[model samples]
Target: MSDFASAAMLRVLVQGMRELGLDPGDAPPGDGEARVQLGLKQGLVQRAVLQGGLACLPLLGRGLRRLAHEPTHQALVAAHSASDLLARWQRLERYVHSRHRCVVEHCDDTQACVRHVTVTGQGAPTAAEDFVVAGVLAALLESIGLRRVSLSFGEQGLFPASDPQGLAQAAAAGASALWQFHWQGRPARGSAPVPGPAAWAQGADPAWAEPVRRAYLHLAADLARPWGLPVLAGAMGLSTRSLQRQLAAQGLSYSRLLAEARCRVAAWRLLYTGDPVAEVGFLSGFSDQPHFTRELQKRVGMPPAAYRQAFAARPVPGR
Candidate 1:
């Protein structure tokens, strides 16, 4: 089975697009079309699907309505690649910019809001220490200068966490947009977009791990905190070193998992909350502010204060 955690991020985007005024007519070419259009480079379309998924969340489908196009009635062989998805998003961003009027303004400190965007492309197989898909999406939004965004593992509405075929088929058929407008243009500010805070997967599943699919479900609300393997191992009745061996057998490591968790937590805290820089660090389990600053800058392309300043300065939409 694939990463269900990652799959849900796309649901957030589909939801976000509808919130932005997207209609069925504005839907872009599917993943298959995107790949064939790009000649199957690598992960482009997949990354774009993931990135657009998140960037479109806060706006709901309104952004999608803005992007809708006449369905390509011509059928072409379907191919899947993450890079092709990213290219499709690049096309979408260009379309959004060209057709819409967007401005970046400042907001009052207390009223400011941080939003995390999550998106995933189609897949049924898991990859190695690569569950940090949300981070990749956040980076995509930042590239377009929407630098004030956070990320979360979305609820894909699929069942049987191990291998939810229903959700996967829905995602493929574009039924993933069911919850796009559920947020109703309401502002969450520092609160998480997901009803309960959700934690993202650090990496791939271990070879010998139990069949439980919702391993990261409890972490949904705790996105602000780093859920380290040591803690998880403690919960799973294994020593940290032993856990390391288990993940190692699957071609992963505790450090890799920790890094993914840390990166995602830092991204959410930095983007969605006005929490003080030091507190953001502490909340994300970074004992040192300097370390947090360095890593956040590396991940977000700027210092926390500057990032917050840029976003907080922007007036809340319609304020």
Candidate 2:
């Protein structure tokens, strides 16, 4: 069918499943000119922790990260400008020969939004599939060296990406999924450098953590304390200004790190521990129960209880 995904793309999902400690129960689709059906893709994603929650972004991002080495992504990375990148993307859609693909609704110097619909002007029936699409596009953007990039997915006034309260409301949207992409222009260098890996995906408990990650650990150690930049900077053996510059370079701030740490810790506890959701949120740097539910809901794409149940349904690894 025209609504099919590339085998290379599906393989990335397989890797994400493996990493999440989920069993690769069935053989994922394989690469070939013969198109693999979208049903295969839908079946694969249905097995994930949740359909569309905050966790979906990074999980899909993690899977699509493999695309950095694929041809479509490589071509996108090779694009010289933001508009140029869109042009190349249009060309890639043609090359795929899929009726269901992303089409640019508008473009400009600052921000642009792409609508993921079919030639019939319909969005993917599956929410998770659309998410996979957004993740790939986001990866391509990051490869272009736009360090501070975030995306809003919904129709106008449904939800702005910045409004924490409305994420899930927009997420529950039906067909006709839209993606509004925001990014900073490339650095003031000689020319647009070749697209490499998206720096944002360089997270998780890597062998060597980023400076911001070290800062995350420090802040995570005590989420209740109202620590400032100076104290954290000193703890990291960096001057206040130096720490600010470093965090800015990585598209991070101390508060952002603290929030992220809480999210990470909360997710971990929900999945592997029997702690009550309220208690888990409290220990993860959240002092207010309602605030904890809201933030984690924004991040993980659901309430704490729901998130725990989603992943908890998965077949644990090594069992």
Candidate 3:
């Protein structure tokens, strides 16, 4: 059991590989509870499976934006403050792997949060696994609207005040690693409203949903550009029609998914970045200024400039 990971985690890796136009023949067979056993080496699982996902993140464009919109992941981000989001993120790990434990702490003065994660019932940790954990944590924090998020394995004199060299050795020996996350000014209201746990549990199928959602995220950054179903299907190793059928089964379509991705990215840029509204629109894959403004008004209920002005002026928490 120490060598085994949950099917959900494996599925994310498989999906990522497919999105990258690579063969996912490495994944174990079957689905559901009976499909729990993933017959692969732990090191391979980390390197090929987990690291593979991270490698394809850039191609997915605005990967965090896609993740932030995921129904289940969104539920975790539905928090009042940075502290609240961190707590929810820890709880969300249970849905990923049963053998892992994530613990988070905040400094009283600096308000910097450190998450120490330990994997019990597992063999020695590899650098690949460490990278995956760090990548996932960074994405989640960004999705919850945190800025200046940084991940480090062992930094000297950081939280818990341990020797950096010893911490690195311990990490290689399968001990916990520390992830440090911070925000500028103070915590502010997250971009989207958090959904209840029940909403997360409903219609949640980790096997299919995880990968398909990942595919959408990978393409999120280029939403303003023209993307055809065939292109997306090719990336996912499916015919255009097959892709359509699969998404339909999950109550999604390529157009809807792309729109949502653009909306989320535009909203994040308007709220967090100083980039011009036109640039945000262009980056979000809008064809032109009018198209961008119209869609943004429709989805966000205001033009980009207005949205930024209204929200950006709000008081930062603990300021």
Candidate 4:
């Protein structure tokens, strides 16, 4: 039976294909020797790239490479325990899969760990798709300084045992894969503390805090659209009054949550993206440039430009 990839994974694959200048429509078949060209031609291979989103894996790896240097990304990886790091990683995975169907599982011993991911409701994956998945996994492990990483497809033994070319060969055989990663020496003491649910809730009750936060994250990027209390309440399947009462129980209000969400997104963009302050403001749902600047200053204690400049000037560690 063929395995399938989730839409979230497919989206990332599509983005990567666009970055690599590959045409998803021209991908080859996924069987026999023809599978060797799976990355290049159209068929199940192409469908996997277009529908499963494996093409975005490479680009996501590249993005992670860059983000590893960003303070926020760095802090996330600086978790004290393997479980903590995995939890944080799971949160990221959930965010990416918000609009799709996928299952991700992580298992960690003290020195070694495995990540098992599968996309439901799809046929078996193509060689090209598996290759991308392996590459993305390798990239993520490398970004976090994991060493001696190995991958195995079911009971087929270590895949891509020696080099990258082997990945295609192994995937040609059609089997599910598991990633194995090892740590060197003592695990480095995390430079940042692992954040609790409270960190995300900002003093709200943990029960409904994550749902409220997730709602904001899902909507934050579309600043030009209307996302008032009624809209958000509807999305959560609650009446406006019910939602309000729930937030009140947690000592939060819809407006405050919205502002906090905008501020969080604005701060990140200000630090990482090269977008102009005004553009960032608009993208973060502010009424105008001045309002964006004012709110940012009020929340972050610095104007957007200054915040960006300050972070930019700080020498990136391990650069």
Reference-based lDDT, residue 153, model 3 = 46
lDDT of 2 by residue, 1-319 (tens): 3575555556667766666566546855454231356667667777663533434433554554554544333445655456656765554454344566777888776777888777755544455566666666665667677666667665422211233235345556563267777878772332333221122233344642377667776665444334579978987899999888877877777677767777876676567655445445544556445777899889878998788888863532320
CA deviation > 4 Å runs, candidate 1 = 1-230, 238-242, 309-319
Local distance difference test scores for all models: 0.35, 0.59, 0.51, 0.48
Cand. 2 TM to true fold: 0.49
Clashing pairs in 2: 53-301, 54-299, 54-300, 54-301
Candidate 3 residue-wise lDDT, 1-319, digit = tens = 3333434344444554555565656556223221144344243344443444434322222233434433334444544456655555454444234345456666432244464444664543354454445455555555556666554444522221224355446545654455565444344454665322122222233555765675565456334224578877886788888888878888888887777666776676566555445445545555545676789889779887788889864532210
Query: Highest lDDT: which candidate?
Result: 2
Cα lDDT for residue 199, model 3? Answer: 24
Higher TM-score: candidate 1 or 2?
A: 2
Residue-level lDDT of model 4, residues 1-319, one tens digit each, is 2222222233334444545555555432221110122223224345545543443333333334433443334434554344444544444333223221213355464333343444444434445544555555544444455555444544433322433334445555554344454444323554332222113324322466665655555445333334678877886787989878777876778888778767876776665555445445544656645777899899879998788878753432221
lDDT of 1 by residue, 8-28 (tens): 223333334344454323333
lDDT of 2 at 102: 72
Residue 33 alpha-carbon offset, candidate 2, angstroms: 4.0
Output the lDDT of residue 178, model 2. Answer: 76
* lDDT score for residue 293 of model 1: 78
lDDT of 4: 0.48
